[model samples]
Target: VGVCVIPIRYIGRKMLARARVVQSSQGDLSSTLQENFSSQRDIRAFELEQQQIRLFRDRIRRYIQASIGAVRWQSLLTPLIEFVSAIAMAATLLVGNMNGMNMGDFAALATAMYLCYEPVKKLGAVHNKAETLNAGLERINHVLNAPDDVPEPENPRSPAAWKGEVEFRNVCFGYQQDSPVMRNIDLRIPSGQVVALVGPSGAGKTTFINLLCRFYDVLSGSVKVDGIDVREMSKKELLSHIALVSQYPVLFRGSVADNIRIGRPDASDAEVEEAGRMSAVDSFINETGEGYSRMIGEMGEGLSGGQRQRVSLARAFLKNAPILVLDEATASLDMKSEEQIQKEIERLASGRTTFIIAHRFSTIRMADRILVLEKGRVVADGTHEELMASSPLYRELYNKQQMVAEEEGGAPC
Candidate 1:
């Protein structure tokens, strides 16, 4: 009995290892399928259907090959165990024949051995199932054991009537400590001022806002709101006072009204419409097949870029928080759409401490103050006109955008 179980256990362990690889391949295949389905518009626009099909087919083949590897090991186990049992049965029969045992005794012993064989086979099959399940469970356990990047403090404090004053005091941060993204950033922004952060792509403009929102805490100095370090406040309580409109707004499968109400779930329908109207979304919502109740496809795929930005703006307006941050809110809009959305953004930012991350000369000109970052450090800080006169980099960036605007047959910002 012990000898028979040995080979079965050995095969089970080997199958378990292979099962993990099969599971990994399946995960990759599933994620790719979902991404392709969600971005079908982009795929069609780029005319990459043949390329996408080829990639998907290759992914499926790899998954099949991995599954077959695990299955091969599983198939070998039962046959091997049965062969071992046959050898044992033959030995027992020969011994019984040499001792001249009675026919009845031999028959009884043979019947018992045959019956045990069925249970042994079933046990081997159960081991195969256990191996597969254990591989899955191991993945789940790994995720469960992972720690958060910014964990909540054991004792947290909520702000008392925060007046929306934001300050970055000698702050420095990086996703990787060795490769710093923002360095020695010190700024004092008064309440209700609109500040624009402008720089080249790697200047850490996005990371700056991300740190302000406590998405990632600073490595050295501190970010403060109303003179209180953000780290000292509860994340939820801290973020409740601020509203952000990101470069790529996220919208799930839901009605337009539902998506807007995500900012404040308990807000009344009238409030949602009021926000939509304020953000220039109400005009277009009426044109949709279902109006405010229109069902959005995954990632809001059915909506145009401007339409999606309007929805995102409506959500931000709905929040009506004291602080607003726009990460290139109008970057992808058309000239007319950009002008309209810019108007809506002004309304949303009114009376709120606002931050803008932009490259458009038109957008940066509206900022009360502009901070020019270079290689993760602030190189210049002043109004647009002041920077144009004093900072060569800022002047060059403005000139580039002005040329682009002129080439597009648009007025210089």
Candidate 2:
């Protein structure tokens, strides 16, 4: 029961965010635009953003419909409970008749006992079943009405073209009130540099990335990009400057072409196919029975891990953003696949500010500078050779990754 309520946190957050979007767009939702909503506004446009909220509401409504069915099933149990109890009492009365107790005495007993049993049994049955359904309804209402995460401001300034310098000045943050995950983090990444972030689990490496994305604002201090506070920039403008490919790739249900085109929605078919070829997905796609038109199932289920990574790389290529974040983007690929993808990344990384987060030291060896983090602090920052001499933590992590590679009967670089 406790575990069941955990997912409600995310569900409630999404629903509330959607509600805000809808409320923000009401003035723009005119009768003329109602007929062809998509044609009138882009999904990110203020007017159409409310559709996400409506979709969320519809989802909850559908769940409520299903819950009603469950409630009916629960109610059916009440009649069964009464029937069983009544039958037991009736058998007791019949036995009394066979034992030669006077029929009048048995009739009096039955009449008096049933009067107590019926009301008591019915009330107990109704209350028990009602309580169970009440819990379900409470969870439903919680998910549908929980308060939202603090929202970004409306009509924020659109940031100018970025030079990719990022600064986190004396930042402190915690998801909860009493405990801070990152404490007084201060760092800077200059333009056109590749910085690698590496740390053990829960050391706040990913949290740093989240701050850069502004997914959650800092508790104190600021994250500035190109000398301007990221919080002041319009969310769309801030995100337009970056492309991210994480360890777990995400793909929607669509043809291969549609997946790649997500990076640049207006990309021509030729351009989309070319991006796939650059990512080394094109050769396999051409050999596929359906070519680029082949449908990728939910989350690219129909494709191999390597295939999915290549498609994600193709998306980054299509996005062609100035700031690139590769969060172990090639983590799951075979050596041959990694080598091919690395070449593509190297080609793209020129003249762009890149942040590479990798557990494998081999992946970060080529990075211009490695930022070693420990307990939310930058413990060491330098090149691979420099870190080997200066930081034992970096060396230990590097040697561990090397040991794993050797244990798998693979050659170490």
Model number with the top TM-score: 1
Model 1 lDDT per residue over 1-413, tens place = 66779988998999899999998889889998998987898999999899999989999999999999998999998888889889989998899999998999999998998989888888888998999999999989889989978788878876677778999999989899899998999999999999999999889999998998999989999999988888888899888888998988998898999999988899999999988887778788787556789889878878988889888888888998899998988787777777776777876777889999988878766689999999999999999779989999998988899999999877689
Cα-based TM-score, every candidate:
0.91, 0.65
Tens digits of per-residue lDDT for model 2, 263-289: 889999998988888888877887867
Off by over 4 Å in 2: 1-150, 407-411
lDDT of 2 at 40: 41
Which one is best on lDDT? 1
| Colliding residue pairs in candidate 1 | none
